[model samples]
Target: MSDPSEMSNVRILGDFRGDPSPSTLRLALAQVLPSDAESRPSAPDQSTAGKEDDSDGAELAMQKLRLYAQTAASQGADVICFPEYFLTGAMHSSWKAVRERQEPVAAHPNPEEDESHWLAQVAAIARESDIDIVAGTVVELGAHHIPHRKDAQHKTGGPGSASKESSDSAVASKTGLRLRTKDSSDLLFNTAYYITRKGEIAAKYTKRNLWHPERSVLSPGHPSSHPSPRLFNIETRRGLRLKASMLICWDLAMPEAFRELLQPSDSRDGPLDGPDVVFVPTCWYATDAGVKGLRWNRAGEAAVLDSLSMARALETESIIAMCNIAGPNWPNGGDAHSFQINDNTKDEDLPIVGVGHSSVHAPFLGCVGKVEDGNEALLLAEIDTKLLADARDTYRVRYDLADAV
Candidate 1:
């Protein structure tokens, strides 16, 4: 375990309430390429693959995560964030197709234990790397567990799927996997977990707004059932504590959600009333099925992303850092023609490519740093609390709203 004190006794730079003496937090966004195994056009069948094969997929993902986390730490980043559904290579249609195949039911016999096992691995990575990690969302198997990827090990026809209760019990005894949540029915959730350098799970936020495709395989998170007020604090190396929160891909399209977070709370600390920074882990794609007569829709989806991200930052007076998955041919070079648009092309002909443009946007400053195009890249930005204070002072949007209400 990493030292908890490393993140403690740090300076608490004030926000909105003033007292900002130029505190900055180094934020790193990993615009990562999907693992070659999972990025393949076709998906692997974990149902038929043995234990070693299953472990291979999980191990490969962890390896990449460690590599990215280490790079971010070396680059002096206080926190490193990965893109959504990054663990399971969400772009490939096969994962979604397989997950939707099963009727809503507990994907794992012991959903809590299974979920923890994977979460622990992520926490271990954070501890070992000694960097705060906003692990990209993963498919959680629980009551309402929707079976996807790793859950395929528990597919009806698989060996382990047979006599699940007995088999899982034996495995649990051998591994000493402890149970946490009691409800085990069925529904898949796209959940994100925040881990401190000390390997402590500081917060978990389930994606509340499901994208069109996700609705078929995933369930939206309801605050009534889960925890309320999805927010947390980050202790940066520069001695600044930032109020932060998480949102998944499609949630960016919902302005009301961002507005809700900006609403004043009952807390005495004014800064705690709203987030100083909002981190969005996304797997947003480049192409969309265009609607007739809508020029914006016909052009591309990138503009929408750019507009919403900037608006969210400016309106809420908070920094918005979005980490999106990279294009198909990322890191290494790819053909330029892959990005070219053909107006005459049919909707089916358009490739499913991540729009990239992983970026950090702040009030007034706009995009402080960004990947720029559909390619693998790392975006690092210094989030200054003074910016937040300045925005609030100049705009007075929060003040106006409070007084009006």
Candidate 2:
């Protein structure tokens, strides 16, 4: 279990926060299967009674999750992956519902207050469990922020970015700005972050393809003007470079986005230019009940992305993991309402269930070991470092056109 952590010069995490925690999260790399315990694929919570409660409810949930995280950690898992917003369901739900509205959703206690505690908890979990973690994103920026615009870079804003004196949130410090996903008018970057097991920020990325109203809340991706802007290059703890990236919930529906991640023509110049793997961490809520799992909506986009990503992973010898939210939407309603700004879904029964098939794809794109079923889980698969080395050496993959003869 600790072998990976100890051997890991750097660890990359892909958190799938199913709902919201508002507390601490202890994720495990992978849990060893017990002979006696039947492998019951985890799914969403059927009961929605606890939807209204906060604080204590959050604590109770954490206690249950602690047991789950401990199971994986004690088993020897090193890097634990979880869903997005793994801390607070209440905030996430309210935010999703109220985000597009004139009124911004506010967490009772404090917005920034949520993630710090969770971050501290994760750090403590790592120290105690001897494991590294990827805790999901939290809605902590209701206050103290700016835009990417030069004038707004250092400018301060009140609460949300609503003032004429407010700054743009696009210009990031050293990591650079997020890719604008929506039209030029919209400006919210669907941000994704990479954290080292040591709890340091390795890299940060944002969703390039906005899903609709989600587009309204996001700006276009960083490389939107370029040939493609849809991948995050991660430095794995194994010293083996992993180009694990994300394309939020709706981005999965964009063919161009996933296609760009697999192909290296723009950056390098051709196929096999490294970045064999792509990661999509999402808030995917399913509408159809018959579907085995929740997939990115927009026709069969999720499956399409899966097929395309798998094909590219095999073609380029990379990996693609889609870590999505698990568990049903507390009350199990919504799908009929549009994101207000103007985006609407064709289907209305979309379940808020954040089910995940957190599995690893081999060089040939075949799945390795098992996959994660429920919302809150850390599914680990051995991403062969040697294989990546062989591919990189066998073919110059960093940048196709850049390294092209």
Candidate 3:
């Protein structure tokens, strides 16, 4: 059993002028991946392969998510977040395979229409568990028809150039666009959905920054002509409102995305308090030998992930909950050490990865609660709304930025 004293403290904020007591939100990070063995159909089912296999994989993934969510809820987690692409597993080895497995967003801008959809099932679990859920990223087929590469390799050169094949033929052949005029379309996006405690869809954020290989199959959320807001506002059951922002895996590597969410807006109507929490769902890969030298002798990928999360949290003065996928089947599988950053701590002070470390960070306190790597587990932490507010009040980073702007 865990000791009660080790649990993070939740302080109440605001004056006691008949205001409701401060609510402590128990946030849970689910760091587990879908089992590849379970996803595979039995030997008897191999006769009808392809589509059946994809559907089976989707179903299995959802089951895993629901089970974990129930566990978190039972442990009294108010909000739970899974890793990026937890719904569909990692990217496949082929673009064609990816396109074939992509699921269409039910009735665009109106996901509630289909109650039996995978995403709806996710919401149902949240509602049943009485917890808000950041259900991770799913491959959403959009309404546009864009040309994509036939192979899954990342492009090394400029646009229209292929690293493994001839430029002219590869570009011309792969760029062939089969126009789709139907209202329901076939464009693909890496999308994450936020489900309220009531099991209602709150917001959906598409990946704006695509990793090199992902560019071959997925489209960016904000194209040149169309724009959308990545940040969202979430209100807890006790009326503790938090300005929340979502960022997919590779998006964290780009500082601009965080800046946009953290920086005060030009309009007077913009949030005066700025974002309180940033949720990052990632499937970051392990660094290769070449990159290890630049990152020092520490755990390459894990170090980078921890550093980025901490840096972002300190710079923005907000709590960061970063959940990552873990399993032996993953590429560089054990390297997926998820971390939360609230401040700087000695590298040696952190625990080494047994499976992968998942944690929650509080403003100025580095790690408030954490689960070391190895087994699948739920990391729960109590985030005090008042403490967060007090930190912002003292730092005044948001106020200073607003004034400077």
lDDT for each of the candidates?
A: 0.65, 0.42, 0.61
Q: Cα lDDT for residue 405, model 3?
A: 68
Tens-digit lDDT string for candidate 3 (1-405): 112332222111111223235566567787766433343332212322333345666677677677767766656666889887677656442223545655555444555556767777887887887789999887766664333343233234777656544543354345322222345355667788889889888777878777765655566665331244546778876777787888887777787787777655667743344567888887653332122332454356666677777777766778888877664422334233333322453332232232344566667778766555534556677767677777777776677767766
Residue-level error in angstroms, candidate 2, position 327: 3.3
Candidate number with the higher lDDT (2 or 3): 3
Q: Cα deviation in Å at residue 279, candidate 3?
A: 1.1
| Model 3 ranges with Cα > 4 A deviation | 1-21, 35-52, 93-98, 101-109, 145-186, 223-227, 263-273, 287-298, 329-355
Positional deviation of 37 in candidate 2, in angstroms?
Answer: 25
* Tens digit per residue, CA lDDT, model 1, 1-405: 323443232211111223324487777888876543343542122322221223456567777687777766765777889998777656424334324433332333432234346667777777777899998877764454222233223324455455756655553343322122355444566788788888877777878777765554556666744464556878865577888888888889898788778666674443325789898999876654332212345335667778889999987889998988876542235443434445674444454555787888998899887776766666777766787888898887777666655
TM-score of 2: 0.54
* Best of the candidates, TM-score: 1
Clashes of each: 8, 52, 4
Using Cα atoms with residue i matched to residue i, what is each candidate's TM-score against the true structure? 0.72, 0.54, 0.71
Query: Candidate 2 — what's its lDDT?
Result: 0.42
Arranged by TM-score, best first: 1, 3, 2
**How many pairs in model 2 have backbone atoms within 3 A of each other, for residues 3 or more apart or on separate chains, i.e. clashes?**
52
